[model samples]
Target: MKLSELGEIGFLKKIEASLPLSDKSVLLGIGDDAAAVRVSRGKTLLSTTDLLTEGIHFDLKYISFYQLGAKALLVNISDIAAMGGIPRYALIVIAVPDNIKVAELNELYRGIKKTASSYKVSIIGGDTSGSKNSLTINITLLGEAKQGNIVSRGGARPGDKIFVTGTLGDSSAGLELLKKGKRSGYLIQRHLLPAPRVKEGVFLSKNRLAASMIDVSDGLATDLNHICEQSKVGAIIYEDKIPLSKELKKAKLKKSPLNYALSGGEDYELLFTVKASYIKKVYNAISKGRLSATMIGEITEMKKGMLIVDGKGQKMPLLPTGFNHFR
Candidate 1:
């Protein structure tokens, strides 16, 4: 049935009934004017929000409402993960177009519920409104971290080693493959379902392994530049050190997969830095299979500028080519 037939209040009732509302940290959940949540003592609250619009952030032709819903929440979770916090509460707001069926929106919420359950997050509240043209989804996520454990992009220092979790460029490669009418591949799954590195972030923060960190949503170069700018430092990543998945390496494409790794966005992996003294600990973790990370380069002085060194030891300025909403 159409949303118009159910009316806004009826639709909201459905949502309230379908989603779990018994989280211990939540004093009040759906059906309230505002959500009430509890934060443990000595914890810092982390909040982040992201907006996804049809035809801009995603294409319905290639993705389902369920996938889109899950992805919408995951992206926001990634922001919290970058800060090394634990996600706990969510506020979802969506603008539904008239052409969308009520069942479809239910599927969307189902996806959100499933993802939230996996992370032990509670969907406390949200707003629904009618859209004139496109479907727009926005999620506000709240997380918590020990007062002394929150990591930021501004903590990087000169000489700190840079590292990233998981292979890069797969999401963009998956996207490109989808654009070419290819389907049912690892690359495509990477694009459709990005796994946020929440546990990795927590591990790094608890162990004091990362000096600075950011998620690879906007490509390596652009996101690294963010860390550089925030920390008042520069960086130099090796061309050969950027990790690429086997699928991405074998995929035939017009541009180099290296380009995708360096410039393509939405990888959702963690890009972090560690002090030289902590390198041994990081390697130890890796050797013991506790962490999946690779040292790509080292932070440099701001005067040195951001650069990428080739396999032949040639240096070149690193440019930011990641997705920009207003670019």
Candidate 2:
């Protein structure tokens, strides 16, 4: 009835019952330090990990166990997608609170299963343990990409156009609405389920269009600076060019929409760079989908530093306003 009675093993048994492990390559699932898998020749492996804590990363009062589980894994998949890779496997390490119900744990695993299945990835192995005060989920995802197809944060060149997939500020808008006890269908959905742009990443990698790429886990301003710092370049972003979502427009938080779009985190959209010459091709490819890529800025020489131009056409130094552990 209660979690303390069922214990970790019992909870794991219930969760494992529904896992359909059809892939023969998955030699082990849900019971080890790591999942062992056979890799095909000539493909490079991409590995990423993310940790979610109860009070820090989420508030259980507003988030469902299923959503918590789904989000824990999907966010790591987003990292692989940013590198232009296909996710193949995952290992989940969960810290459970003694008071959490066995039924709740099962619901969490169901969400994890749904997310992994949606991405065609297998949960090969994991570990479970008891924590004193809160629940924590740590997930490591492994993926593969062609040797030369992998994108990184250090490849941007001066004159390349900066583009982002989909409109921004929706997740932050959703958070704002949630905090105010107001409901906007789009914002709520955006917060609950943020889509990773895997197909778009693959398209960019295949076309050789993305010189550098990073996902908008931190706000656009912070993530873009990551590319600039790594590439040893500077950037100039135009305030008017950044795409703001319809939900953000409707929410109309006291802060300007541009501020939310630029500084609010958890958007999960892709931020990428393309040479000016290939912009047309990139635009054409994304046009086929409902999602539109907006070009908001350009890479510049290192001496220029990162700058943002306001509506008055006055340029100002851009500060990192995105998520930082220390700040």
Candidate 3:
């Protein structure tokens, strides 16, 4: 049946069923004018929102509604993970075109429900509306972290060492493969369902290991640039030090793996810095988290600027050439 027949309330009833049960943190959820939550003393909350559009951020032809729904939530959760917080609740607002079916939207809700439950997050509330154009999903996620445990992109010092949680370029490489009709399993999934580095973020934050942190949503070059901009420092990354997935390495594409590693957006891995003194302890801590990361670079004075060191130790200017929304 068409959405006009089901109307807003009818569709929302379907979405409500897909949500997880109430938790202690959630004081009130759907059916109210607004959702409410309670928090512990001495803790800070982290909030982030993202907009996913049909042609801009995603394409409906290649992306299933279910995957789109999961991804719509996952990307926002990545922001919380970047700050070393535990995701708790979310408010999703979706706008759908008339041509869309109720089944498609329910599948999308299934995707959202599965992801939220996995992260132990509650879907407190959201709004759905009819759209004249493309399908759109907007999610606002809230997470909490102890005051001291909240990591930011601006904490890096001059001598801090830069590191990344997982291999880079996989998602971007995967996207390229899909566009070319190449069905490499892992690569495509990496692009379709990128995993957030929540565990690593929490471990490092709790242990006071990371000096600065940010997720590689817009690729290593761009995200690292954000840290530098916020901290007022420059960085030098070694070409050989960047971790590239085997799948990305094996992909036959027009762009080099290094280029993908440098400019590919949506990796969702954490890129962080640790003080030189804490490098060893950080290594041990990450071992306990079962995450392997590489020390790719170091923070330097602002005058030194961002550059990439080649294998032979040649330094070249590294442009912030990752995915740009307006470009």
Which one wins by TM-score: 1 or 3? 1
lDDT by residue for model 2 over 150-269, one digit each (tens)?
778888999999999888878877877777776447886777678888888888887789999988987888888878877899999999888887667777677878887888878889
| Rank ordering of all candidates by TM-score, starting from the highest | 1, 3, 2
Q: Rate the local accuracy (lDDT) of all candidates.
A: 0.88, 0.82, 0.84
Residue 2 miss distance in model 3 (angstroms): 40
| Tens digits of lDDT, candidate 3, 1-327 | 877777544575688779965686654344321233446766766777889988998987667889899999999888888888888899999999999999999999999999999999999999999999999999999888887787888888899999997899988888877788766589889888889888888888898899889888888998888788778999999999999988888878889999998998898998999998898897886667666688899999888899999999999998888876543
**Who wins the TM-score comparison?**
1
TM-score of each: 0.88, 0.86, 0.87
Whole-structure CA lDDT of model 3: 0.84
Query: Mind giving the per-residue lDDT tens digits that candidate 1 earns over 51-77?
Result: 899999999888888999899999988
Q: Once model 2 is optimally superposed onto the true structure by TM-score, how far is the C-alpha of residue 268 displaced, in angstroms? A: 0.5
Task: Give the 10-residue window scoring lowest on summed lDDT in candidate 3.
Answer: 27-36
Best by the lDDT measure: 1
